[model samples]
Target: MPGFDSEFTPITRQRLFAGERLRAIRRRAGLGQAAMAARLGISVSYLSQIENDDRPLTSAVLAALARHHPFDLAAIEADQPTRRFAAARAALDDPVFAGSALAADALARIVEQQPAFADRFIALHAAYRRAEERLQMVDEGLESGGGRLPWEEVRDWFHEAGNYVDLLDRGAESLALRLGDGDGALRDALAERGIVVATNDDPATLRRLDRADGRLAISAALPPESRRFMLAHQLAAIAFAEPIAAIAESAALRSAEARRLLAVGLANYAAGALLMPYERFRAAARAFRHDIDRLRLHFSVSFEQACHRLSTLQRPGARGVPMFFCRVDMAGNITKRHSATRLQFARFGGACPLWAVHEAVAIPDRIMTQLVETPDGVRYVSMAKGLVKASGSFARAPRRYAVALGCEAAHARDFVYADAIDVDGSGAATPIGISCRLCPRADCDQRAFPPADRAIAVDPDIRRIVPYRL
Candidate 1:
């Protein structure tokens, strides 16, 4: 009674009859016109008028029908001329429909006349996007001359799984509990299985596993964290052999090489999980407010390891703030990527240059933070730090990369990097796009290419920062 208004406003006067939706609902419910009219608390003649579009449905009748009948009101509302016309117009704006641009009235008429065709067009556009991504991957493989390499297949497999392997995670957590925490405990566990763990000063080999001789060799030149990670990776291979094999076999990869790479990836995932147990790490993350430095010190893991572990904190009931993690080399190639958030990385090219991750490359060891907004209007508080992994010799160059971690603005309160920034304030956020080619912004000077979905206009007399007007 409180929500239902007795007097209808002028806005309600525009109500058009959704006779088709009403008839469909009635037929699905298997109710005759008389019974439907009785249930809706309306006279049979009035119901017939509503069904035949001879009368518009009023507020009182709509409320009565909602109270008595089970129907999707949202679906019925979407059938309104205004909403349907808007959807059709948005679809027409797609680059696929570029050459055949229709006037607003024309598009609206099409939606009104052929709604099924419009819906199918939207579905076909979505399918086009999926196919485009696959094509990009194929092109990359061809450029590399490897014909879709095994490592790329494994990477795509992980991407499809949301970057979290539940079976491997749980198995690793159980193994960690049994082996206990700390490097000493891990060493003792390995030793008990007749696997002698020893470190060698030779920089040529990072890690070597001899199964027949039951010996594991690690490089002494490597740092404590790296050494520990390598040892844990080996332990995963030995301890969870059956589970890892089952997961690899179930993948049904085209080549044995891909399956082997997948097994290694699963082992690496297991090693990360073992190094930082989920519950303990999540609680510590909350306590530290997700400060990467403090987390690395507490867990005795490297900065990259800490960030990678944070991305995998997607357990069922207990979960951490969803974050996107990525590593970009000096060449701007994204070597690793995973997102538990809505933010998706560009599959083909480098990340947006305006992002803080690129800046981190110039300023090593310092963590850079920026509040960035995507083209879709979602804001993220991103943090990045440049790292150099020494090759332990002057003859070889150190591996240079910048690791980036971020979460959506909703999780800003939990992220330490967002502490200094005002996320809610206007004009304080940096506008970033998914990629230059896919971005819709026209005036961006940093844009390397024009948007694939939009038309460009070039004038010799009128030149701006960008040559073409989009």
Candidate 2:
């Protein structure tokens, strides 16, 4: 695996008023002030001062806590004043709070003194936003006279579930471990079950399994990585049938078509999990600093598969960096989308044309990188790669699409593509919106349409890049 070289620099050294977090940690560990102070090699009065917000937790105290406590130091660090301040600031960018947003100092003070209240407010705002988006999606479906499309229902099911299926992920990882041995592990496992695997070259379907005949065939049209993925998909269909059915049943989807689609999606997820088990893949990703090419090479999976798997590493207490992943076709349609970060994809139509993913779609086999700031002022480091899958014949058209993976700029350290971006440098990041109809940027030259919620005024006498004034 390839790794990047970097200078070790601290993101911040500001005074952290983490009294509430400190107290919570101590209480959770059932330790008194004196006991915790002793463990941290600090005076009881100093510890008391720190807990009471009179003094900040010094680097030495943080180090001591890390060395002595069994808790997640990273979690503790993440809950500090800086992160809270960022979250509160971002949440306040919502248009609903337009004129009544708090100042930076006041927000920081509130986060320091009443962290729980701040958290609840952010959570409430988030839920309200989700509701609004869902309503918008429903409105679009109704306008189309589709009455809530089954595929959209299935998409929302995955989106609401955070794109990380715990039961399927765990089951797949267990199966991967049990298969044992080297490169031929999957094939060996199938052989043990008296099944023969072969290449079909039919191109009609990706895979076909005749259970009664103990035979399985994968399309030769697919590349090697996709072939292996299909193999894992077949394995999941057999070994995880019950769990997949249970998950689909519990989803309470509106249509039988939706339930069937959910099952297929779950099976695909299980196949990815089996091909690249969670723990091993996450460890490798961290080690390589999330280099997509290296990850694909190491796991013998496709580029899109590596990126998709990276987006799903959201296990509790062992989460990977929060990321957003989407696949866009040449027509600008978002075929697959998931976000573990603050960024969300457009629910109904095409994505922002300014997004690098759209550009990637025109130029296959090359990776594109960009530093983009959303309309809400959140910056992200985005990486996109265009790919074409062969149909194994000149007459059959190939499949062309681009997959994008990104995380907040704050997580630039863990993302390989972010090395090209100067996180602290002064530059105007390319401004983008979720979608044309949802975007608030009135000045965007590439905006195909005005925001759906806002009224547009047309002046026949005057003309600009956009036809109407928003």
Candidate 3:
């Protein structure tokens, strides 16, 4: 409870001029100048001036508009100009640009004078970084259609989409509103379809559906939260089948197996959305400073489910704190990964050994927090916890994994885990990276291997933790 309510604190800015964003809101609402002006209780000329950037937006008009419309006022107040300026600066700071980085003033000038070019420059840098990452990653298989696996193809599809399916999310939210009841919603939904829902004592499968007998059985071995999630997943797979199929079919996947995998992924996304309705869940998460236990209890969801849902809160306007979420098995294999921030997870091999998630995997049920700086100089506050799911019988082994969730240091105030660390102290962070092969920190003593593309020279007489020098 110490860091709760941090996100509700108001932010102060020196100036606000987001005319383009205001104009976009008006266009999205399909309202003409006169109508928009009337709704905001302002004159048409005044509205036109504001939209054209001839005048700054006042708080009173913004308040009036928020009262009349369903817009995310916080997002509007965040100022696109400031965001673009920061993005331009960050892209320039990438090591690829190194000593040729532009000054803050020069970057600001470009953002102000040629916004389109600035945007393009940032996008090009992102593409370059992605290409660099792919090159750094170990080849899973050949790039040809025959060698690419369905799971990998589906993973890439979700990654490219930023793990957010807008249409499916909104549709699931609508269904949630209709259901009203919490866990009972899933049962009622299945019951309406003439299917009897019950729990099965079998430990072999999570859930089994028998259309022949019009019955659905969920594994009784699961915890209460997971049971509910499994129910939602089964229900979503049934209700959202058409849209899920459409999305899968729309993908440029080469094989039928890839399409099938994509459809399952979409259905899983929809199930999470249905169980934790976006607007309500995001609001609660902000209130709790993204406390996983608080979120899981409030939403009646599993911890992993809550963490996974947090990563998908990228709904443009009503976005939550941007964060990366991943799950690591006991072997340090990252089974799940997504980033709404600059921190990308390694696509192959284990994650960086210095990451706290690896430590959490050894110590189950305890939350571990760490302040880490990636090679790019961006700091993050991470919270990781190891979990064990019961197998309900001694004959079977339980599933064990650790989940990590974190955001960049800029949003540290809104992330509760950062409270115990010094966010402003540059030297307080432990240096970390995506993986050993992808990391650029040659001085790190815990490095497992050298960069795949960088040649190293070995000193025959030299003695150090690592035998070779970069």
lDDT of candidate 1 vs native? 0.76
Return the top candidate by TM-score.
3
- What is the C-alpha lDDT profile of model 1 across 130-214, one tens digit per residue? 6866654555445456455687778888877767888878888888888786888888888888898987777878999888998
Candidate 2 structure quality by residue, lDDT tens digits, 227-343: 888878877877898999999998969988999999999999999999899989987887787899999999899899999999998886566777899999989989999998767
Query: What digit string (tens of lDDT, one per residue) describes model 3 on residues 258-336?
Result: 9998888888899999989999988888778788899998888889999999999989778777789999999999889
The TM-score of predicted model 1 comes to 0.70
RMSD of each: 13.3, 9.5, 9.8
Output the TM-score of candidate 2. 0.78
Off by over 4 Å in 3: 1-74, 77-112, 133-147
List runs of model 2 lying over 4 Å from the truth. Answer: 1-123, 139-146, 181-183
TM-score of each: 0.70, 0.78, 0.80
